[model samples]
Structures are given as structure tokens and as C-alpha cells.
Target chain A: MKRSLKQFRYETAESLHIALFQIRANKIRSFLTALGVIIGIVAITMMGTAINGIDRGFDKSLAMLGYDVIYVQKSSWSTMGQWWRYRNRADLKTSYTEAINRTIEDNPNSNLLVAVPQMSTYQASVQYRDLTIEQAFALGTSYRYPQTASGDLSSGRFFTPTESAAGTMVAVIGDDIATGLFGEREAVGNIIKMKNSRFRVIGVFRKQGKFLGLFSFDNQVIMPLGAFEKTFGKKGFVTLRVKIRDQKQVDDAKAELLGIMRRIRRLPPQKEADFSINEQKAFKSQLDPIKNGIAAAGIFITGMSLFVGAIGIMNITFVSVKERTREIGLRKALGARRNTILMQFLIESVMICLIGGLIGLVTSFLMTWAIATALPDFPVQFSPALVFASLVVSVATGIISGLAPAVNASRLDPADSLRYE
Target chain B: METSPVITMRDLKRHYSMGEETVKALDGVDLEFLKNDYAAIMGPSGSGKSTLMNIIGCLDTPTSGTYILNGQNVAEMDDDELARVRNREIGFVFQTFNLLPRINCLRNVELPLIYAGVNPREREERATEALNRVGLGDRITHKPTELSGGQIQRVAIARALINNPSIILADEPTGNLDTATSQDIMEIFSDLSKAGNTIILITHEEDIALYTRRIIRLRDGRIESDKKQ
Candidate 1:
């Protein structure tokens, strides 16, 4: 009877069992053989996981800017002090911002909410009584500033739009500014002096975490836009901050604002706007090239390691074939076919690699998990694709290495082999 | 029924060349052995007894001659065909009792059947029966290292019989054993012959040859004598 594929499978299984038996009988040799594959798997898996985590973290940070939000600034991209170049040129002043906001609010499809015009200037050593903080950023914002920025409030209320319109001298202090001025005591409703003017603190914000160890966003203070214009003069440029009814309506609101700005500025048709409208998603798209480069490098390095493991497998299988020559001859003389002999050796090679691959896979998973747990914010998502790829790599390695030995086994002359002694 | 000759060879010439000279290991020898015969091939060193045994066992091809075994022209057959015939029709017991080191006695016996494409369940049943026949059924799970030299040879005999081949060819099956152990193995061979299986043994010892019913003596590459005891 012709041997079915099932029989071949059984034979291969038996051969694998025999191979494992031999390995178990020689423990140190087997471990040394599998070492290269283990190291390769660990390197590839860990690198992939780390890169995935970083990608996730970048996305989460971008999502913080609300997917629906768009910024309309004097110069393209948000950066401090870029308006100086446009200084002599007509800056985005309060009049233009007021005109855009009023037009958008009058439209039937208007989803704009509490549009605020804001500006900032850098100065060092702002003092309160005997205490002085270095390099304080002086922000001039409308009373609706808290609504646009969304800084977490620790205590007291934010300034209203009415307060901003009336040019009130009220301020909403950040956590750091309040602590610096009041020294842990209640700074709410207290008067702090800034730029030779008195401002009353109506609220103190919670901590905004560190930005390169300079000061948190919570370290700043808020005041009515009109109050800043009244005190410092109505000449500074303003960037418009508008909130939509919801995130979904942000695109419509931005379109309406753009149309209003175009009409108010009177740019001819077919002319691009002098200002820039930027989205957080644009920054994320820029990171793609770096991600691809890292992925390619990881694959190349891991492939080299897998190759080394394959070489090890080939070397060991060759040694096994040499050692088992007599036994192989005996089996052939007793009636084994060429394919039978070939499959036996091939199964042995695959078994060796499979064991190594399994160990490597488990070790890589544990390593990635341990590293991710150790470092929280730095992303490391250990994906199953990496694991599956590692397994495929190992199996392919086994097949490549086993090919030579299997051919040698099949090519042995049964007549000569019987007398091989 | 003991009828026709199971093996028939005519002018079998097996020659080997050593650099420049030709050596005829089996020179123009004609021989025949019928079924159910227990025979012995005896000769001194360099007497071509082992060469004749190799041809008869289908392990080697004669240089030139007609070798008809069980009415098939095996001398004309290819290497693969000869291997198939050998696996189907011959059981060989070696001087070293060549059992695979890593496998147990039962697996060793199942090796030949495995190559014959036998199902595992049938292979196991047949192997167990063969092991039982050789008086090593209880020790089937034991490796060769755990067994005595005589027991290993018995396992080898069981392995040879597992496929129920046409003949049991022993090339000095008792060579590695002591006198008592050799006698025990010879007794097994005698019992196998009585049970209707053909037995062909190669040996130089006169006492070992005495156990066979027929003896063929070789001197240099020629048949010196053929006698039934």
C-alpha cells in the first residue's frame, strides 16, 4: 500500500520525537545551538514593541489638542515671537479678530463659541511685594481665555467675557504663579503687582506639569484682553481662538472664520491667505518617515540574527548526519526508502528550530512586558504580528538548514550503506 | 510444503579492483537454496564467505551473473527495486546487533515495518508479537544499554522477524556473545527453522556450523564443499 500523507506526518512526528530525545540526552549542546535564535527574537520583538509604544504616545499627545480644533495665527505654525517679523506689516490685531468673530456669529450655520484674541510677550523678573520670579511670560487674553485653553482650575472662578469687555483688572493665576506670589497661602482675591499695575487674582489654576523644567502652563496668570489693551496700549497683534459647539463642527467653524477673515482682509480671488491655519494631525503625519526608517532597521538587524541561527542549525544538523551514518545505513538496509530517510533528518532539524523559536518567543514577550511596565509613558505595545513573524522566521531557518542534511540522507546507497561499518 | 529453490544463482562473479589488480570475491559460483532450509556458509579469512552472504542478502550486487531469488531476476533490478525487494523479503541480523541507540527495543523492532508503510497500530501489534517470540516481550521498553549482550541480540532477532520476511540472514549473529550466549542464539535459530522460516548463517566456528542442517564451505573464491549434516 502506498503510504498516505498521514503516514508521512506520523513518520515526521516520530522523527521529531527522536530528535528531541537526542537533544534531551545532550542538554548543553542543544541549549548552545538555540542561543543565537533566542537573542535574535529578543532584539526584534523588543525593538518593534518600543517603536509601537512611541507611535501610540505621539497620537495620544496629539489627541490632547482636540481633533476639532484649528489654530489661526499671524505666522504659520504656533511659535513664540514670530509676529515680530510681521510687526511692521499689519499684525492680526483685535479689530480684525472682532470683525471675523462678529461675522461668523451672525451666520446661520455659526457654531462659534466665545472667540478670544490672545497675545504674549516675554519678560524676566516680575515681582510681587518682596518675591520675584524670573522669565515670566506676560499673556494678554480675553476673559474667555480659560474656555479656549482648558487649564484645570484648582480654586476660584475664571474671568468672564463681560469682565474682559469692561477691561476689569482681575487675574486668574496658574498654580506656580499663585505659589510664588502667596507662598502657599490663599492668593485668590489678592492683589499682585505686574508691570507697575495692580491686578486682583480671582482664581488659582492647578499644576500644568513641567515643560523642559522652565515652568508649567499652570505657572502663568490670566487677565481680561481689554484690561491688557487698556494698560499696555491697543497696538499689539492678536491670534484668534474660537471654540466650536462640538468637535464635529470644528471644520465648519474654521471654514466660516476663514471666509470672514478673507473678506475683512480683502485679499483678491486666487490669492492665498497671508496667515496659516495649522492642525495637530499635520505634525503626526511628519513622524511617518522616522517610523518607517526605524521599522526597516529593526527588520534588517533581526533578519541577520535569524540567518545566524539558521547557520547554527545547518552546522548542527551536518554533525548529526555524520554521527548517525551507521544507523541510517542500518535503517535503509532494513527497508527504509530514500524519502523516509530524508524526512527523518528533516524533522529533526525542524524540531530543533521549533524548540529554539518557542523559547525565544516567550523570552521576548516577557522582556517587552517588563520594559513597558518599568517605563509608563514611553510606549511599548507588544504586538502579535511580531510574535508570529518570529515563528515564521524560525521555521524558515530550520527548513534552510535541514535541506542539506536531508539530501545527504536520501542520497545514501542502500547497498553500500548496509556495509558502511 | 518444501518445494522449489527460493534462491538460485548462476556463475555469480563479484569482483573488486585494488588500484591496478582485479580480485574476484565470488568467481563463477552456482548455488541454490530451497525454502525452510537452515544452512551455514563457513570459510577462513579471505575465503569470500562474507561476499557470498552479502549477495544472497541483497545488500550488494554481483559484478556479473544471474541472481534469481523467489523466481525474480534481481540481478537485472535497479538499486531502488532491489531495496524494495530486500525490505519486503529479507531479514538481516548483524554481528553487532545494530539496534538504534536512542530508541527502545519495541521501536527498534518497529523500524522495518515503519519503512514498509505499516500503520502504527498494526506495526505495534506485530512488533510486540515478534518481541514476545524472541523472549524479550517484558523488556520491550528497555534500551540496549539496560540489556545484556544476549538480550540485545534477541531484540535484533525480533527486529529482523518483525516484517515476516522470506529469510533470516545472520552474519555471525553470535560473534559478540560468549559460548553460552552463542549456544542460546543458535538454539533460537534452530527453533526458527523448525517453525518453517529459512535461516542462512555465516560463521567460521565448526561448533556453530554444526547446528545447521546444511553447510557450504568456501576456499579462496571457490566452493570447496557442500554437505548436509
Candidate 2:
């Protein structure tokens, strides 16, 4: 038999045409065979899209905490594997925060560390003239708090440091809070009552969207720390929010704050400091292992789906070889080489996989869109690299599945094949 | 005999082992065919006519035989070499035509050259020429199912002739065709033979056997008689 790549390609293409025609002829059978592949791809895609969206959401949440800014909290914010242990600790006291503020004030080099106190309650009920909204969260912090609340200033101005120092009763409201307290009217300078204590709204926060059916940053009230302490009586203890000048100095600053707090509290050197220090980056780091686990699971399951698809392709190709035995004999008798036969069938198998994979890829993109719509915080990132990877996988499925059958077809004895019924 | 015989076989034997029994399909057969010879082998069922034809066409190798085809020892040739010889020196036309149903006439005719490693542009040109030679000039784009039985046979013949092989092997070439179509195919065979191509056919039909200049009869896995018209 004359053996050339050109002839092989031509015959391969011709054979693939026949295969497709056969598939088209048995539409229901072909569709049913592809159904498993379709379900697998869609399930994998949807799962992957959802997980990827969450990962992106996590990233956006981190982004809200500016990369250039370094946050210092009383407790280490990372809750990896020991959430209960951290949760059981006694809350850091307000006197510790006052001492930390004094320490930062006294040291010119540490003056970049802005010390602020926080007092928050999630079950607070608010009343605006006639309407009252229950289960609203109220936040009380120093005037410097808005600088850390990146999404907390949608309208009007944050309260000035002078007002906070003097313990003025000014608040920053979230969009939902503003709507509940002031209706459509401008909320700046409006007074809203929380726990029968009235406070003036200075700013309304931007909408931060929803997560798992819960409203986010746009539904809370932000008040100055001094006024919060006066009205709420500073009873539940306070967390010191410290801003560092440079992220590189966070470790040194943390050590300094712990030392100052310990000295002020007059604790012995052997005793554990009564506070924890936290960083936003550490919080993200805590979430990484879970995301990685989810990612690995997705890949493995998706890989199995592709394997199943390959098996389907091989089965179909084998059937095709059986059906075309006479044709194979005729071609051989006409001088088709073994390699030519092999290439033809192999290409046909690959084409089938390519078609299936292409449909899967398109469906995955659509699923990505749905994911983005539902969880806007999640960034469902679809990179060209992923597209390339999927295509490679599909092609690999084709080559691997089609190889044995194509070889079988190529090795067929012309005499036997011609005689095949 | 200044010119060597194109095919020569000595004591050619092919045996199939069916469990504990060995059935001799071709037993100690000796044969020779010169260049441009038009011949036929005739026999009843189980007479080994098909087996003999397979060995002669290089589609099967005889056990314990010295078979020299065109001065090359065919028995010693590997699978690739045998395939090459089959592609370059022999064209086979089955009784059923066996044209691929999905491909058009031209592509069917081009099958031989494809395995022969010809480029596409030349393959198309040569396939077109071969199809036209078989009097299928206009129906080159029509598929096998779209053509008449005689046309499909012609397309098969065109495919067989694509590489301009020295020998054309027809295995019960008219077994599936009606009398008229069979006669039409026989006429094409005569034309091919006249064009200096050696032709060998295996058939049981007396009428089909009579078309060739020579006839060899096989009986019970052995040559019974050989005669020239």
C-alpha cells in the first residue's frame, strides 16, 4: 500500500466524515452516549465555577483591606484550626487601648501607628421617627475608623478627629441603615436612635453587596470611639485598631504594643499578654489551605469525567471499525497503508472528542457567568490558560482512546475484512 | 525466456490449524505467470481457489513455499514489504466492489496512491485520470451508493489501476452483480488486460472463467488441471 501523510490525512478526513454521518444517522443513540460526558462536564464546570467565584470573592474581600495598609488588632485575626481556642479568650480591655494610644503619642517614630478603639453590637435595634429596624449592627470607633472602613463612605464626610476627641455623637451609616433611618431623604445630619440614644449621621457607606444571603459592609453604623464609649459606657471591653506606617514594621510594632500593654497592666513577665495582634494578610493565609483542597478535588473529579468521555470515544471508534470492515478491506486492496488507516481512525476519534470538549467549554463559560451574577464578590476568573488546558485534555482523550482501535483497523487483513458480513 | 516470469511459486503450502486438526488450504502447489498474462482459477466451494488467489496477490503468505514475485522472494518479505508490493505491483477488485460508501468516486480511486505516499495535488490529478480512464469522468464526485453497481465496480477498478500496478487480482469480481452488470465488468477487465496489465481472477462460474485466455482448476486444495484457451 502507498503510505503518505497526505493520503492518510485525506482518508482520515473521509473516514471521520463517515463516522459523523453514522452519528448523525443514530441521533438519539449518539446523544445518549454523550449525555454522561455532558453531565460530567457541566457538573464539573459548575462546581469549579462556584468554587472559583468564592475564591475571587475572598480576594475582593482582602482587596477592601488595602495592600499598602497594615492593620494591627488586639488579637491575631488568623483562625486556622483553633477558632474555638481564640474565641474563648477574654476580650482585650479599653484601658489597654488607652495605654497603646499614649504609647504611640509619646514615641515620635511610632506616631505613624494610629491607635483607635472599637465597640460594636450586632443585635441593636434602630428607630427613625416612626419606622424601626431590628437586628441592625451598630459600630462605635475612633474618627480614624473610616480610614480603615474602605467601603464606609458613600455619601457625606466622616466625622473629624476633633469631634471624636470631644466625644461628639456623630455616625456613619450604611446604605441599608440610611434607607431604614432616613428613607429617601439625605441622611447626612439626620438623627437616628439606637438603644434610646440618638446620634447624628455624618456619612452613608457604599453598598458592599451580599454574601450567602447576608447583607455586607453597607448595612452597619459607624460611630466615633469616644461617643460610643460615653453612650454605650465602654462595658464590653475594647479592641485597639492600630494602623502602621509600613507593613514591614508590623512585627516590631506588635512587640512594642504588647510590651507597653503589659507594663501598663502590671503583668508579670511569665504571664501571657492579655491581648492578641491580628493582620488581614494572615486572615487570607488561613483561608488558603481550604481553597487549595477544594481546587484539588475539582480537578480530580473533572479529570475523571474526561476519562469517561475518552472511553465513550474509544467504544464508538471500535464500533465504527467493525461497521467499516469491508470498506477497510477495499481501501487496503486499493493499496492503503496501515499507517494511513491508523491516522484516519485516530483523527476521527480526536474530532469527536474535540466536539464534545468544545461544547463543555462553552457551557463552562455560561456557568461562570451565573456564578459571577450570584456571588459578585467572587471573581470567576476564566483564563486562556484554562481553555488551553481543557483542549489539551480533550485531545489527549481522543488520542489515547482512539489509538488501539485505529491500530486494529490498520492491522485488519484485507481478505478477512472483505469477507466480513 | 529472456524476460523473467513476473510471478513464480514452488511447493506453496498454506495450512490452518483448527484445534488438533490442520486443514491444508493450499498443498504443494507450483505455478508461474508471465508478464501481461490474463488468467483465471476456478473451483467449487472448499477447493482452496480463494487461498491460492490470496497467496498470488501477496495478501497472504504461503507456509514453506518459495514464492518469487517480479524477481523478489515474496515468502521472505516482511509485512511492510508485502504491503509495498501489493500497493505498487498488484490491484485487487473484490466480488462486492467494496467501495467506501461515504466517499465520492474520485477519493475511492485515490486510495492506492494515498498509501503510496503521493502528495494531495498529484493524488487528485492521478485519481481524476484513473476515474476518467474507467469512464467515470463526470461522476467523480458521486458516492458509491449514488452510482450504479457497474459504476461502483468501475470505481473500484479505477482505484485498483491508480498506482498502475503490474497485476490486477479480481476475487469473484462479478459474484454480486446481475448477468448484464457482470458482462459489463468483464468487458472492462478485457480492456485492462489489453492495455498490457496482467490479470488474475478467481471464480467458479464457467462463463466468468472463459473470459480469460488461460484457466487453472483446483480440487480439494490441489491444482487439478491447467489449460490455455
Candidate 3:
């Protein structure tokens, strides 16, 4: 057994050497054969990178929504397109935050932490001095709003609870709003006009990127609820952002909130509640089918390329076996076992594919780098796991493609093969 | 001189099916070779000399009867076992001096020991020594494409000798060489035979057969005569 193992090791080494020599000798043929694998691996890796980028971008957007917070709103975020289902529903009142907070304070074992109310409009415009910024988002929330949101203040502070209760006309602006209105000037203590209502900029949020490349978080102006009501009226969309005690217990928290909402709505036992409780997970569920569709289509197309590549390798290997029939005969006559010949051909094809995979990986990496450099906002990430998966795929392709030809080469009749012209 | 037989064959038969007809390639051949015996098998185009050589070299199996080489049954062995027997007990030199043209002379000569599972260091050592014995020691790194017909044939002979097998089987070893180069190859075999190695030569040329100690002639598929030189 030891001797046979040694023999196998030696034979494998010899086969590898032969494979290298063959590839080097037939450089052009080998490269052309490997080109198919190169294209396949590039397609696979690029597709994987795109999917990874989408996942990363989605996660980043979800983080902006705050994982530990759930929202009580009129329309469900998951079925956002079919707003008609919620058109006749009563609007969620900002006053529900007080009732939810009272219920949380009453129940010691409640999964709820604290609730904060938010009111927002996307059509609001802000003006300072001679410049006016249009379509700036305007949000109204309480002093405890920071506990349920993601951004941090780069300067100044959020409105105090006393100021919030007194309906002070102070606004905390996003980085984009600060930079746009102030432009290298300090934003804090400066009064900005919105809908003819004057407001002092008390704080500025640090820059946060767009959410799913759709909504910009860095373009909002946040003010106290009462001040927003005075400026834009009380008819704006309302959301109750409730912070949970534990993110992992979000399902229990949602259930608890659902019951609290039903009680608050004073619905009969059989009548459905008018409000929808939504979390970041609803957005994820909504996007999942679309993401999966992209992935499935990408994989199917890439798999077809890999399949074509494998066939190319197989055809080239068959030709190689036929070309070296005399060598196979000689090796056998010199006492090489059937498996030795088989391994030689297999190693040759595998070497070709492995080289191709490496080249493809480098090419994809460069292309991704170029894309990321040219368009920094476009999501394209190359992960280490993708590298590993593509290499494994290349080796598997080589084995699958080389099997039949290698077997055929190994089974050739030595006597007749030697006599072959 | 009486010596123990290194190879023994008893009424060996080899048959092949060619469509609807059965061609008896080898029919009722009985032969023996003692230790260090130098012999030549002579036959016409249709004779069974090639079939006999293949069976003796363990490249093919007989349809019936027993053949023994180095006290192991070659007739009943499976493919892998036959491979092992070939690696251990027989070395084959082909007509075309089938050296893989891309590899150097030393690598070509080391082919048999590679199959025999010899380590690289020792395989190189033994292959060098065999090439030195065949008078091409200085051309160890040269490829077959760079060598003369006689030198390539000599590299083949070195390969045949690398394993120190029980018998060296040469099937038309000088068939592709000119008269002068053939004589040079025959002289190397003559020297090897004198060094106490058993050798078998298959050739149609009487002049090449005359160099061996014993000659066996075949007609159709049976031995016509066997005579000592």
C-alpha cells in the first residue's frame, strides 16, 4: 500500500510536469482553449459581485431605517405600489406615540422601549438669503427622535424637550441642506425661511448616502412637530417610530404593537385595524423577489457561458488525446498504468482551466475597480468568497470536461497504438 | 550450457475476430528462453512474430495455453498485473525508437523506472548510467529531435536497460535505421548480451538475425524452424 501510494504521488507529479510542458509547447492552442473558461469565470464573478453589491447596498439602506425601530403608518411598505388598499384608511396620528409610551411604561416586561412621532413632506423648499433649494425633505419629530433614527449631529444639538414643548421654530438640517443653504458658512444660529415661516438652524446632520439609490437622507430639514404644524399644517403624512428593546425580538414587539394599535384604534373584535406596523424587514421582503429574479437570470446566462467553455475544453482535450496516441502507447509500454494516462489528460485540462480562472478573476477585478473608480455610487463589490467559488467552479468544469477524453486515452490498445502511423 | 528458463511458453494460441472470420494470429507456439539467451525471431509479413512479441512483452494476452516469465504467469494476469509484470520483468524497444520528442534524453530513458515507482534521484542516477553504457552519456539533456537516428535508437536501448529487466524485447529495433546505424545499434545489443542480459530481436532482415546466437523462423502462424547459430 505504501509503495502504491508513493507510485501514485510520483505519477501525479510526472503528469503535472507533462501537462505544463504540453501547455507551454502548444501555447496558442492552450490559450484559445482557456479563453472559453476565462470568459465563463469573468461572467460568473462579475454577476456574483453585482449580486453582492446589491445585497450590501440594501443592507446599508436598511441600516439607515434603523434595525431596532418599527413604524406605524397608514400604508404597508411591502405593498407600497398598491396604495389604494390604504387610501380610505384613517391616517396614523402622531398622538399614538404618547399612548404607546404609556402602555410600555405600564408593562415592565414589554418588548417596547420608547416611541417617537415623525411628520414629513418631500415637496418642501427651503430659502436662505438669495438662494432657494427646492424639493428638500422637511421632517417634524420630538426631542427623543435621535433614539429611533440613524444619523449623528455634526454640529450643534437637537432641540431640547422644553423647546420641543414650547413649539420653538428651530430646525436641524441634513449635510446637503446645510452645505447648500450655508455654503462654507456656519449653519447653526442662522435663520432659514420655509413656506414663509422663519426657523433658526440649531444643528446639522453628518452626510448619509442615498437609500437604495432612491431617497436621499442627507437632504432633509428636521424641526419640532409643533413648528412643522405651524409651517406646513397638520395634514402631512404621520409615522410613529417605535424603538424596540431588542432587535432580535422584533417579531414579538411587532405583535405587541399590533395589539396596542388595535386597542388604540378601538376596533371591534372582527373589524381590522386601520394602521400598518412596518419594519425594515418589510422592505427586504418586498425587494427579495426582484433581487432573486436578477440573480437567477444572471446565473442562467453565466451558466450557459460556462457550459460552452466546458465543451470547448472537452473538444480540445479529445483532439489532444488523438494527437498523442503514440505517446500514450509509449507510456503504457513503459509500464504506466491505465490511471496514469487518465490523470495526465485530466491534469492538463485542469491546469488550463485554473489558469483561465485566475486570469478571469484578475480581469473582473480590474473591471470592477475601474467601474467603482468611474462611478463611486454604483454598487460593485469583489469579495474573497467569490474568488474561492469561481476557482472551485473552474476545477469542477475541468474535471467534468476532461473525464470522457481522459478515459478514452487510458483505454487505448497499446499494441495497436504503437503500430499506428 | 544448461540454464534455468527465464521464460516458458506451452502451446500458446492467440485468435482474433475479423468481422465474420476468425484469424488465428498465433497457433500452437511452444518456446523457451534460458537465462541470458540472445535470440532473434524471423518471419514474413503475415507471420505471427509480432503477436508472439506482444504476448512475450505482456502487451497482449494469449487466447489459450500458459506462458510464464520470471516464474509469474503472464497468460492469466489482468491488465494492471500485466503492466506490473512488464515494468518489472520486460523492457521493450520499438522500431521507430519512440522517444517522446519534446523531452530530453535523460527523461526519456527514465520513463520505465518512473512506472516502476523509482525515486527521481535514483531514476536519474540509473538512467544516466544506462545512457553512459549506450555511449550517449554526454547527450543527456539533448532532445530526440536534436539526436541522430542511431543516437535516438541508443537512447531507446538505454531506456530498455534502465529497469534491469529479466528480458529485453526489441521489435524491429533497427527497422527505421540505415545499414550503418543498424550495425551500431546491433553492436550495443551485442555488448549488452555479452554483459549477461537476455535479449530478443524481431526482424525480417537475415543479416540482423545473424547477429543473435539462435534464430527462430515462422511461417503463417506457426514456427517453421528453430536453429542455433
Candidate 4:
């Protein structure tokens, strides 16, 4: 048995050498056969990278939403774009924060920590002398706004309680608005015009990239709620930002907030809650179906390419067996076992597939790099797991496609094959 | 002193089915060959010389017969067992000098040793020695395509001798060669036979048959004459 095992090893080594020679001798034919595997591998790895990038990009976006915070607004984020359902509902009031906070302070076991009111619009414009920026997001909130949001002040401090109470015209501008009016220079202490009134920049919030990949969060102009009402009117749009003690208890907090809002709205048990209690989870739920749809389509494209590649490999292997009929007979006469011929052909097909897969991986790497350089916001991730997976897939495809031809070669009658012209 | 026969056969028959007809390639032939015996099998067209050579070489199994090679049951052996018997007991030299064209002389010669489970270093040493014995030592690195027809035939002979088998089966080994090249190959066979190896040649040429000590003539799947030349 040991001797046979050793014999098998030597036979395999010889087979590998022959396979390499054959591939080298017929370079063009081998390359043409490998092309299918190349394209299939490229499609598969690129799709995997895109899916990974989508998942990572979304996680980054969701992180910006502050996991521990929930929003009390008239429109639901999960059911967004169907605005008509909530257009007839009464507008959410900014004072609702005060009521929610009062009830939370009354209960010692409340999951709610604090609530801050935010009233904003996308239509506000900012001006500095001759330069004017339109479509800037202007937000009005209490002094506790930083507690419910993410940007670190790159310049000055947040508005004080005294300033907030006095409805002072001091603003902590976002990074984009700061740089837009001030250019690389300091904007703190400089006055910018917002809707005909001049407000001094107290602090400049750092750059926060995009919000949910849609609009820039750094283009926002934040100020005391009173100053914002004075300029944009008291009735633009309102969202009550409530911070919960534990993110894991967000559902319980949402229920608690729902009960408080219903009592405040004077709603009975028969009616649905007029306002939508929203969170980052609602956005994730909405994004899941779209993500799944892309993933399903990607899998189908990958499967189709690999299937075609397998068929191409199978056809080429059959041709190779036919072309080498006499060689097979000679080997058999030289005392080659049946498995030896099978292994030789299998090795040939597998080597082609492996080489093709490596080339495809390198191609995809370059493509990912180009995409990353061209559009920095668009993510493309190529991971080690993906590399390992494609290689295994390539080998498996080779084996599956090369089996019938290899078996046919192995089973050929030596005498008959020797006479094959 | 007398020794047992190296090959024994009795009523050996090999039949083939072609649709509705049965073609008897070999029919009820019995023969025995002693160790170190050198013989030629000759026949005209439609004769069973080629079929008998195939059966003797263990490339084909006989139907309804008992044939033994070095005391192992060849007729009853399965495919794998026959392969092993061929590897250990028989060496084959074909008429076409069927060397793999892409590989060099040394690798081609080492093909049988590979099947015999020899290690790389030892296989190379033995293949080089065999090539040297065939007067092609310096051309061991030359591929079959790079060599002349006679050189490729010598390389095939080197491959055949690599395993030191009990019998050398040469089926018209010089059929594709010129007269001078055929003389050189026949001379090599003469030397191997003198060195105590059993040799079997299948040929239709009288001159090639004359090179052997005994000639067996076959016609219509049956032996017509066996004479000591």
C-alpha cells in the first residue's frame, strides 16, 4: 500500500509536468479557454466588493445618526416619500420637548435621558458681504443640541444657557458654511447675514461629510431656537430629538415617548398616533429591501458567468482529450494507471482556471483603486475572504467541468487509442 | 538443468463482437516461452499476429483461456492488475517510437520508472544510464521533436528497458525507420537478448525475423509454423 501511494505521488508529479508542457505548447488555446474563467472571476469579485462597500458605507452613515437618539416627527423615515399620508396631520410642536423632558424627570425608571427641540428648513440662505450661499440647512435648537448630535467644534464653544435664553444672534456654523464665507481664514467673531439679520459666528463645527449619503451635514447653520424663529418664522418644520439612556432599550423608549405624545395631543385609544416616532433603525429597515435586491441581482449575474465559464472549460477539455488520444495510449502502455490519465487532464484544467482567477483578482484590485480615487464617497472594498472564496470557486469549477473528459480519457482502450490516427 | 517457462498459455482465445458478428482475433492457440527466449511472430494481412502480441503484452485480456506471465494469471487479471503486471513484468516498444514530443529524452525514458514508483533522483540516474546504454547519453536533454527518428526510437527503447522487465515486446519497432536505423535497433535488441532478457518481436519482414533465433508464423488467428531459424 505504501509503495502504491508513493507510485501515485510520482505519477501525479509527472502528470503536472506534462500538463504544464501541454499548456505552454498550446498557449493560445489554453488562454482562450481561460478567458471564460477570467471574466467570471472578475464579475464575482467585483460584485462581492460592491456588496461589501454598500454595507460599510451604510454603517458609517448610520453611525452619524447617533444610535442612542430617537426622533419625534410628523413623517416616518421608513415610510418616507409617501408624504400625502402625513401631510394632513398636525405639525409637531417644539415645546413637545419640554413636555417629554418633564415626564422623563418625573419617573425615576424612565429610559429617556433628555429631549432637545430642532426646527429646520433646507431653504435658508447665508451671506457674507458679496458672497451668498443658497439652500443651506438652518437648524434651531436648545443649548443641549450637541448632546444629541455628532460634530466636534473645530473652533469655538456652543451657545451658553444665557445666550439661548436671550435668543442671542450667536451661531456655531458648520464647517462648509464657515469655509464658504471665510475661505481658509477664521470665521469666529465674524458676522454673517442669515435671512436679512446678522449673526456672529461663535463656533465652527468640524466637517462631518454627508448625512445618509444624500445631503451635506457640514453645510448646516445652528443657532438658538429663538434666533431661528425670529428669522425663518416659528413654523418651518419641527423634530424633537430625544436621547435614551441605553441604545438597546430604544424600542421601550419609543413606546414611552409615544404614550407621552398621545396624552399631549389629547388622542384616545381608537386613533393611530398622528406623529411618527423615528430612529436610525427605521432607516436601516427601509434600506434592507433595497440592499437585498442588489445582492440578489449580483448573485444571479455571478452564477450565470461562472456557469458559462464551466461549460467553456468542459468543451475545451474534451478537445484536449481528443487531441492527445495517442499520448494517452502511450502512457497506458508505459504502465500508467487509469487514475493517472484522469489526474493529468484534471490538473491541466485546474491550472488554467487558477491562473485566470489570479489575473482577474489583480484586475479587480486595480478597478477598485480607480473607483476609490475617482469617487471617494463611493465605497469599493476587496477583502481577503473574497480572495480565498474566488480561488476555491475557480478550482471547483475546473474539477466540475473537467470530470467527464478526464473520465473518458481514463477509460479509453489502450490498443484502440494506440491505433487512433 | 531445466528451468520453468517464463510464459505459459493454453487454448488462448480473444473474441470481439462487431454488431451481429463475432470476430475471433485469437483462436485456441497454446504456446510456451522459456526465460531468455528470443522470437519473432510473422503473419500476412488479416492474420492474428498483432492480436497475439497485444494479448502477450497484457494490453488485452484473453477470452476462455489460461495465460500466465512469470507465474501470474494474466487472463483472469483485472485492468489494474494487468497494468501492474505490465509495469513490473513487460516492456513495450512500439513501431511509431511514441515518445511524448514535448518532453526531453531523459523525461521520456523515465516514464516507466515513474509508474514503477521510483524516486526522482533514482529515476533520473537509471534513465541516464539507459540512454547511455542506447548510445544517446549526451542527447538526453533533446526533445523528441529535436531528435531524428532513430534517436527517438532509441529513447523509446530506453524507456522500455527502464523497469528491467521479464519480457521485451517490440511490435515492428523498426517499421518506420530506414534500413541502417533498423540494423542499429536490431543490434540493440541482439545485445539485450544476449544479456539474458526474453524478447518478442512482431513483424512481417523476413530480414527482421531472421535477426531472431526462432520464428512463429500465424494465419487466420492460428499458428501455421514454429521453426528454429
Top lDDT prediction, candidate number? 3
TM-score of 2: 0.91
Docking class of predicted structure 3: medium
lDDT for A99 in candidate 1 is: 79
Q: What is the interface RMSD of candidate 3, in Å?
A: 0.7
Clashing pairs in 4: none
Q: By how many angstroms RMSD does model 2 differ from the true structure?
A: 3.0
Displacement of the residue B99 alpha carbon in candidate 2, Å? 0.9
- Residue A1 error for model 3, in Å? 1.9
Q: TM-score for every candidate vs. truth?
A: 0.81, 0.91, 0.96, 0.98
Q: Give a tens-digit lDDT track for model 1, residues A1-421.
A: 2465655666666677777788898788888888777877787777778687768767665654556566676675444356665445456766566776677667756766656677665552456788887666666787656566645688999887688778788877778788877887998878877777788889888875543223357556567776776655665446677666767766776777787777877889897777665566566666777788898998898888878887887888788878778887887788766777887887777777778888988997887778768965446788889889777877777788889988887787665665565
DockQ of candidate model 2: 0.57
Can you write out model 4's per-residue Cα lDDT over A1-421, one digit (the tens) per residue?
9998999899889878887888898899888888888888899899999989988888888888899999999999989899999999999899988998899999999999999999999999999999999999999999999999987999989999888878899888889998899999999999999987899999998888886689888999999999999999998799999999999999899999999999999999999999999999888898889889988998898889888988999999999899889999888888888988899999988988988888889989899989999999997899999999999989998899899999999999888888899
Candidates 1 onward: DockQ, in order: 0.49, 0.57, 0.76, 0.83
Best by DockQ: 4
Please tell me how candidate 1 rates in CAPRI terms: acceptable
lDDT of each: 0.79, 0.77, 0.94, 0.91
| lDDT score of residue B22 within candidate 3 | 92
When 1 and 4 are scored with DockQ, the better candidate is: 4
**Which model is ahead, 3 or 4, in terms of lDDT?**
3
Q: Residues B48-78, candidate 1: write the lDDT tens digits.
A: 9888888888877899989998988888877
Interface DockQ of candidate 1: 0.49
The superposed Cα distance between candidate 3 and the true structure at residue B86, in angstroms, equals 1.5
Best by TM-score: 4
Candidate 4 docking band: high
